[model samples]
Target: MHSSLNDHMTLLKEIAEFLNEETEMETMLQGALKKLLTRSVFASGWIFFIDGKGKHKLIAAENLPPALMENDCRSMKRGGCWCVSRYHNGELQKASNIIECQRIEQARRQSEKSSGEITHHATVPLQSGKEKFGLLNVATPNTIEYDQSELALLESIAFQIGSAIKRIHLTRQEQEIALVQERNRLARDLHDSVNQLLFSVTLTSRGAMEMTEDMELRDAFHDIHQLTQEALTEMRALIWQLRPKGLETGLLEGIKGYAEMLGIHVVTHVSGVIQLPSRIEETIFRIVQEGLNNIRKHAGTNQAELFLTVNSTDVLVILKDDGRGFHAGKIPGTLASVGMQSMRERAQAVEGTIEWISAPSEGTEVFVRIPY
Candidate 1:
């Protein structure tokens, strides 16, 4: 009998191990209850989870139809109803008969009144540490009574269920920690990258202003010098916007600012959302900046479209231009020295990805997605 009880404990642990890896808490609880009932050969069993209103939610049960599992109340007199009070007081028990139960007077009173057969019962409460999560109920006919061994088996199973609950809680905590670390890395990379690029452009502009002499040539040089200065300014603005400003004012204002400076046809779509994390919003902004730069330099188109989608766990940004395009597969140059590489690095830094669509004459499209 000791050997058999040990085997039961092993089975209990196996069931809990299976449930612990599940993402949905509801599914894990139901699976644990199902396995418990099947292993013990109980005449009846039930699992109840507590709700916000302190009501019991019938998560799973045996000897009860699916729809009837919840919202069904039997008379307190029947041997069937000793569970509520036992659960309320946090008791685990193994009894040969309901008459021998500690609360026999109450059990008998309800049993006699319900007109239902008396059944032997064995039960245990499920918990994580000191918190009582719920109760497990099991019953058998009087002839098939519970011995000390059976009671021990029920206790072992309850421990396994509790362990699984704790494991899942730990997993979610780990995922959140990982997310925060990735965000910090991205913020650092953006600061390093944009600052260097803008600084070089600034110095180049200042040098050109001091080196020119011919009136017409100086004017042309001045125009180019101003263009470089503007690029530096754009880089600074893009960096500021990526640093986690609120969704409504930050992105909308940034887009409007870009439109005014570019002096081209720029249309933005609100689509189905707003509000994005600094890391995520920054990646999208960089991808757009790169795509438009490539268009202005290579494609010669004046009109562009920018679209953003912020959903439950992801942010998607798309920038499309009606300008001449080129082969992206043959992209050459270090990411830091080139626009395409910078965009890809920014996307990767924030747990995001980028996709490029372009041809020699059909224009270009840059699609970026960041998962938060």
Candidate 2:
């Protein structure tokens, strides 16, 4: 018994040391799982990460059965597990006997063809204080029951895992918030200094154009005025993209303002009220900005239409322009070359989808669908 206690203590120390190292969430979880397997008697284990949207994502797993891993672990990814459902429903707060493993039961039903041995598992909610991150599940092939000490050890590991996850999440949130704050500061500076200066230059150049009588001087002044005006337009677009003030009012209003700044007439159609998470809102705004930038640079038209339909589940955004369009198949170069890749990435960051459709001489269209 003393040896067993020493082993548990050593396991706890090792987990503490492993988690303290600079490692990503996945790596930390996997490393912890490896340590747990070495120190304990569990045959297999996995971790579910609950995201901001309250969706459970299976981030790490080890020694999972073939049936479960089939189809990209569709069953686990779909959140059909008994332990996860209990965790979501606030039933399983601490490590204890909850329900039989659904994967094991399914395998038992198909025992004739099942490949690996299965056994009952224990699950513990990984949480820091009141913030629940997810669940840690462990199972052994043998039919041995856990003692109080074993359960306590598992709970301690779960606590460490939860604390590490919370730290990682808070750090990421801080980084993202800092980035947004910096972007806002830069946008303000540009609007106050560069944007104002450009506007003044445009007005001064136009005044010179009107006052100059010589043809050459008048033409020179006119060119300068047009250049300044174009520069101001581009600068305004950049400022809006960096920090959209209109988003404070509404997404559609912000987008309309941006389009107008680019000298593009936008016809907006809205169906439902616009309500979304801030990250999703930022992604949609960036996507629209990229689309408008492409229109100004390549579309060769000053008219565009934006359609937004929001529902409880998702938001649909379609931006169409009647411009000199190119063939979608032969997109001159990579999608990154035309900013489509960045837009696609932003959409994907929110578990959204974006598509582009265009044909030579026919208008171009950008479609985006994001879940709230």
Model 1: CA > 4 A from native:
1-10, 16-27, 43-64, 67-123, 137-149, 195-372
Candidate that would win on TM-score:
2
Please report the TM-score between candidate 1 and the true structure.
0.39
- Each model's lDDT comes to 0.62, 0.83
TM-score of 2: 0.88
User: Which residue pairs clash in candidate 2?
Assistant: none
Which candidate should be chosen as best, given lDDT against the real structure?
Answer: 2
Model 1: per-residue lDDT, tens digit, 238-296?
55344433334677666545544555567888666676666566556656766665655
Tens-place lDDT digits, model 2, residues 215-258 = 99999988998898888888888888788878888777888888
Whole-structure CA lDDT of model 1: 0.62
Residue 68, candidate 1: Cα error in Å is 1.9
